[model samples]
Target: MKKRLIYGWLLAGVTFASSCTKNFDEVNTDPYKATSENFNPNFLMSQAQIQFSQTGYDQLLFQSMWVQSLASTFDYYANGDKYVLRGSGTGYYSRTWNRGYGALTLVDEMKNLVQGKTQYSNLDACGTILRVMFIQRITDLHGDVPYSQEGQAKSGNVAPVFDKQQDIYKAMLSQLDAATAALDLNKDKPSSDLFYGGDISKWKRLGYSLMLKAAMRLTKVDAATAKTYAEKAYAAGTMTSVADNAKVLTDNANGNSNSNSDALLVADDFREVRWGKTLIDIMKTSNDPRISAVAEVSAGTGKAANEDRATPGVNTASLQIGMPNGYDLNGGATDISKAPNYPGTSPANPAVPNDAPAPVGKYSRPRLTVYDDRSGVNMLYTYGESELLLAEAAVRGWNTGSAATHYANALAADIRSLAQMNATPQAVVSDNDIASYVSRNPLNTANTTALQQINTEYYVVTSTTFNFNETFANWRRSGYPVLTPVTYPGQYITGSIPRRMPYPITLPQTNGANYQAAVANQGPDNFATRVWWDKQ
Candidate 1:
């Protein structure tokens, strides 16, 4: 019953095209089986748009734990929860690499199909924007990646050299700038454009917004360039409101639902995930209304005799607690009952018998009604994120806007966007609450704490939504709201939180020379080595 994007119809068209093409190929007997010219560019664009937003099962397993927004109570999830990167844990690295490059290949095919075609100039621009988006994610994960020589297997360069992160950033910014400027509204647009629905104006906003994000990322490392692009992006019209958010919609149907919902539905292990103590503590301290919107009360109240019980799954801001990271049943205690501060107060534990419920469900899980809802929107970029980044730009003396106004606007947009996740009345943040939160948490004018304040708010905003990758990246760049590194017994990287993910294990065997070259140029192929932009 949910509103579906037009992808289904487009996919059917692609299928029909494929079936019809077989007859033509059989009759012609051309040396090459098929060419890019044989396919509709819209179909390629549709696939790229969908694939670009597809984070799949890896995000819930790895990113959520890495950012400390979610944690696991069982040994099964200890690999990720405790930073143990062995056998199964290493799968996260491989899955992300595969998905990212797989999507980029489709974008490359689309680019090849539309390149140098005067009539499809706008489509070409769209392809470039998508390429930048896809490649940025890859470079962010691993410092040096195959950018220039990527997807060039047909050109006979199977072993492409790795591009440095700095070079990649420069190229991405240039591409975005050119692509955004080249998007002509009068030109024909793709009918299957899922993100913008063929609206060139919104596509332009998304392109500039991505530019803003790339520039802000270099704040610590390259202040001058960061300032330059941030100003240019703002002038070119970055996302200004929730209406301009670049989100992909779902229909709540099989094979068409939100990726997060799909993962949660099929994987029983994912159900073990609950809110992390670090995030919950901050939200509870600030009395953030988003906590109730994002998380639910423990299903089972571990209370003894004569205890008053609170209703399960109630949206009481005070009753929601989170499980701590980096402890398993075998590590210290027999179970949740024996663990110190079993479902401790602050966000109070449920009122059920101590031994009655499983430890995993004994604490708060993410709000299933919203987050796990199949019809939910997968937010890629948003006005809230842009405003927060701009707020930081203002703090850095960039000619964007007043820090106070941007900060207030960021808070308001974030609250309003959460309401759009579902029609739950409790999730809808009131204007009074928005105004009050903004007023209370005004940007710290003092230079010493201004950047910290802005980045910390960025963390809070990204946590409620499914922006864990950005949350981790910003944390590394800004180092705000200082997080404690978990020192679990069998942790792989010790003494600090991860700076970047390890390269996929298959890289050495698949592309040994290039893999070694990248490892040598960028620091050792390990989690502790900082990426180029993460100078802080």
Candidate 2:
């Protein structure tokens, strides 16, 4: 189904290639003409939307969380088998550049295409919202980033100045507000909205929901402003069910089949990760129906995670002894296979050996089981995320909605989302599983414990995504889903858990004065110090 594109914008000197045209002067020839119309704008939009989760972007943010470095790397796992995120020693400077800043390449495209287009206002609005989301995520993870000048690289921004994280947020929030306000269900549908397929109402809902998320980011430093913005976002409608969950429709390369979320989840990071004890305990405690879906229980994981499994703190388990970050440095079928935790050293399809393998998925990093399907498109935003935002808002009395109900809804959405994987080979968890969790946990809606549960859920669900940008965000804000310090065989640095990733090595030369100023304001150029948000 390859569609022809608009060829009116091609350059004068460029030679055009085409099967349909008779001659060069006969047909149109624009550079992005084919890219613009043939691309199924929906697909293009989705590509931008999922940029943060894409291969082009995964290694930095996603890999960071998978490895659980406050600022650096260690190994990883769903079962918490070893220690540190994969490929340690050097912090992921390039990885961050791609996943975070690199993501802007696509997101900015969406922004530029939307400018001044009244006909595609809905699409434009949607693009703007997503663009802001990606931007905020980037700055949040990497402190200051080049915002205004980023993407203009060809026009002389080869080395853009880094904007402060605080300033970046301010700009992002402004954009989000504009996007939200611009959302009009009455506006013409793009007929190409891949996320919701021309559903303006859905787009509107997502915009508001994203607003809540952005606003929530300010909670630590500016609670009053956070609450004000939170209220505004809630006043706008939000997702009410799982059907409204927003994710791209990802397909395999030969592009024939649709894989499961876990395919992507357990794909590469699978090599890098095992599991952490804290996550194991949480799943086991609630008799968590999703445990089996997310992780393979270690020989003693069930017993180890369950002191009193019915308990809320029942724990995701403890001290998983996560794998070292670069455990598979040798990079071979044999290296990835003999993880010590994996049951068989040899896989069924060796060509596609060691997880998704080369020809299969082409994923460079390891993955967790939760993202089982690499084929599923990037999850731009979801109802589950919206509800959690609402729950947090309600907790703060920022809005009038029932926070408890939203909290429960948030948990329920993930459970249902993971229901299949959650069920064991022996038996599927039914109403009994849900009831047991709710009763024992006793979500008072008013309790920090309830909030913590949801926050923890947010971290796990987020941690299981493509690369772990959001997972780190939650960790900084709430301090839940506790992870132990990584004791790398390298320099100890007192084995102190890292609090912030150091500014990239290039920053000193690139934006020396501003970078120095930020460091001074932030106090302690060392990674051990917390960010502005981590008061606790």
Q: Candidate 1: which stretches are off by over 4 Å?
A: 1-35, 252-254, 266-271, 299-312, 331-340, 344-355, 360-362, 422-426
Write model 2 residue lDDT over 469-524, tens digit each, in one string: 56667677776766655433442233545555566676778767766776776665
Q: What TM-score, over all chains together, does every model reach? A: 0.87, 0.70
TM-score, candidate number 1: 0.87
In candidate 1, clashing pairs total 5
Name every residue pair that clashes in candidate 1: 301-350, 301-351, 301-352, 302-352, 303-352
User: lDDT value for candidate 1?
Assistant: 0.78
Q: Measured by C-alpha RMSD in angstroms, how accurate is candidate 2?
A: 10.5
Pick the TM-score winner.
1
- Per-residue error at 409 for model 2, in Å? 1.2
Error of 1 at 73 (Å): 1.4
Scored by lDDT, model 2 comes in at 0.55
